[model samples]
Target: MSKNKAKKEATEKEYRKPLIKRRKPNRSIAGDIALYLFLTLVAFVMAFPIIYAVSSALKPLDELFKFPPTIFAQHPTTDNFSDLFITMGKSWVTFSRYLFNTVFITAVGTAGHLIIASMGAFVLAKYEFPGAQGFFKVVTVAMMFTGYATAIPNYIILNKLGWIDTYWAIIIPAFASPMGFFLMKQFMEGLPTSLIEAAKIDGANEWKVFSGIVMPNVKPAWMTLIIFSVQALWNNKASTYIYSEERKTLVYALQQIQAGGIARTGQGAAVLVVVMIVPIIIFVFSESQILETMASSGLKD
Candidate 1:
């Protein structure tokens, strides 16, 4: 009887194993479904504005001000875009020039930030110089201050240097960024010290070690800095560019479209849509690569 009881208990335990395994899989599937639903909702919220802006830009003048707000334009026209170029039968040649100016400023500013920030961060992370920790602490504190607070001082300095209304006014001030330095420093700190030591053992100078070994390893951080710099310069508004009428960015140009009153509403929307496309395209193409590289680097580390 005791042997039969033991056999029965063994059979019951065997049946319970399958039930436990099935419960785990069911719970995992439910969790995955919940996460997907949450992500889908968030995506829609973010995409709605971009979709609306494009639709508004394409809407005909008659349908632009409709009461309920039409989600789709019945008649799309390119007339608004054409009007931006033509002013009283003669082309406003300055439009393209201003666009190029913005591009140049953004490009130079982004590159400068990447090089300077990465180098500074590498030094702070690897070197054991005196006052290093204190200096880094100061940088962290400086980052907490908004750039707008220094606009007046920046403008005055630029004015002293006769840089107002020139590309220097925009580009020069952007190079001194504390946030980029901080981010790069944090990333550099996480790099394996053995790599730096190995490079030095081979008689590589400090610059060689930095460029040949450290920079390559921190590609993700570098890409992140590029994205940040691009976005910041692209959206900058609180500089002399705000005060100077002749030297206006694409953002300022878009505002001018509204100066003609309510009849030109469609044109204003078109100008906004055109200006927005470049940044959106850049963000879309770079964001995925940046995220993937960062994820892989983190996993490897």
Candidate 2:
């Protein structure tokens, strides 16, 4: 009797309908067209500068100097890029050396910032200790000030430490930047305490919990942080701290070409495109992760 009742209830349950039917949004053809047009306009506006830079880089000297300057080059050529290479080849220091300095500084600074910021954020987010809140408050306050505001203090400190004219002058300062710390801590706050506790219960040590558990979950935050750190360090000229020509960056070398009074105009245009390339590529690949991090950064259990 009980078996028959159970089978009958199961049959009845199989045919039950959902209580609430999902409704499609009401459609408006005119509104849809208008919305699409607006989005297209905005995207073009945002992308125009990048397009213009590429166009300018391809333009010949005559076209570049034309009275009514065009957005797109009529006769696109690679002469500008060729000239840039030739000019770089003629420099006192090899272009490759300047490139090495920039790449080395940017890579070291970005990696250091990522590791230090993540560790600091992990401690602040997962553990409670004396002066933690106060320290974070200091970090928040530090974020409010721009690099220009702190330049003098940085120079003085670096000078005192005798790091002036060295890579440490720039790389060390980048590691202490508060932007990554603030961002990572906020995003990590949304991670559940119980998940971390569970790892601990399994006999995972602090380093294991942080490396195996915490870091994997905060991918978006750190990826976005990489973009910011790379952009800053890659573009930095460090003119004030490092006076050595060999120690100067690619940007500083390119800026000399740019200031060469009308003769290197095309090469200068190519320089702009080259400088923009790395950061743009990095951002494009990580854009989705960044968007996810931004959207869910504030949500917590």
Candidate 3:
């Protein structure tokens, strides 16, 4: 009867315990407050430029050149944006055409770069082959040179291939960009080889292993690569190669307005906002994916 009573008491104690235990913070409340204050200051500093740009875009011509440029507009107006649209309406090439060209190029180029780079990175990271190390070394060296350094060579090759006036000149080069491939390869190296081998042991083919297993595991890396690729392609003017007015990007159109001297100063500020907004939006939306760690931890035994 005593043993039975003891068992009943133990059961009652277990039921009384909380299901979830909360961890105690290592830092005191004062420390946490100080840390948050410092972070807020850093964030404000970084966001200052973007805030200033928006303010400038809203400022009228007179306020824009005021002594000691202000971070916020005194009397904000949409005149700059309205004037920008009016000026764009005067261009021979329709604004929609420029928008379409940019969207198409950016979308196609980013997609192509992601797929091709991911595949190449998969091969380099997972498989061993003759000259693999040497090939990766070449890619690492290639990344050191800026696009300006390779501009002439790219033009010459495109000219030979009769792609000078065509979209292929830009899109093709983007597919072969070294940055995405390098990033993906580095990220993929951290993925567990055992997970891949397990997939293979289940009779999965190479493509299945790559598309199903490897790609999903390296989500953060590719999302970052997308941001880089989009930023590069979105800002590209293609002036050196693409001569046709109809083939020009939205950036080229805005740049033309920006060069209209002091008369178009307000419009020029608006142009800066328009050009930068798209990439900023893309980055904001994908930031979570970029920061997320690989999902391999849960899959482990």
Candidate 4:
């Protein structure tokens, strides 16, 4: 009798349920289309500058320098790039040398910044130490100021230490970014304390826990730090500290080319396009990781 009753209820439940999932309403479909259109418009607006740079770089001299300039190229050619190489060949410093300097500075600075900032974050976010609160507060306060604020004093100290005109002036100062440290600290705050405790119970030291647990977990934060460090170091002209053509960054060299009259404009646009590539690549990968981390975090609004 109980089996019959259960079978009857199951039959009724199956009868009430649909075999297929319901399709979304026309209103929902319309909303999705509108959202995608809006996003597409926004993306185009943000990308216009880079697009224009590449277009202008490929345009013939006549088209690139037209009155009330155009956004699209008329006669696309590689003359601008050829001319740029020719100009570089005539200059005292080779173009590749400038490229190498910028690459070295950016790579070293970004790596150093990630290590220093993440370590600082671990200490401040996880550990209990005297003056830790005050130290973090100082870091927070320092974030209110940009790198420009310290340029004068930084130059003075570097001059005293003879790091002036050396890569140390850029690399060492970059390692002490307050904003990166603070950003990492905030990201680390979301991490679980239990993991660290468990690691300690397993007889792991601070370094082991930091390397094995904290760094792996905070991949998004450090990736974001990489973007910040690269942008800063990549754009660094530092004309004040760096005087020689040998030490000057690629962007600075490009800036000089861009400052020339209409004749150099095509190559200038080429330079701009090249300079923008690395940052865009960094941003694309880091953005995906950051989004993934945020989704998995399961934080409530």
Best by lDDT: 2
Question: Candidate 4: where is the Cα deviation over 4 Å?
Answer: 1-43, 66-70, 291-301
Off by over 4 Å in 3: 1-47, 65-69, 291-301
Model 1 compared with the native: what TM-score?
A: 0.78
Q: Report model 2's TM-score to 2 decimal places.
A: 0.86
| Best prediction by TM-score | 2
Model 2: clashing residue pairs? none
As for candidate 4, its clashing pairs are: none
What's the CA error at residue 145 for candidate 3, in Å? 1.1
lDDT of 4 by residue, 27-67 (tens): 47679899999999999999898789889989999998688
Give the alpha carbon lDDT tens digit for every residue of 164-231 in model 2: 99999999999988888888888888899999999999999999999999999999998888998999
Better model by TM-score: candidate 2 vs candidate 3: 2
TM-score of each: 0.78, 0.86, 0.80, 0.82
Clashing pairs in 1: none
Report, for every candidate in turn, its global Cα lDDT versus the true structure.
Answer: 0.77, 0.89, 0.87, 0.85
Choose 1 or 4, whichever is better by lDDT: 4
- Candidate 1 residue 247 C-alpha distance from true site, Å: 3.1
* Candidate 1 per-residue lDDT over residues 254-274, each given as its tens digit: 666667688778778787787
Measured on C-alpha atoms, candidate 3 has an lDDT of 0.87
Model 3, span 1-301: residue lDDT tens: 9999999999987876643232544657899899999999999999998898899999988999999988899999999998887777778998778888888899899999999999998999889999898898888889889989988888899999999988888898999899778778877888889999999999999999999999888878877889989999999988888889999888998899899988888998898898899889988988876665223212221
Give the Å error, residue 71, model 2.
2.1
Pairwise lDDT winner, candidates 1 and 2: 2
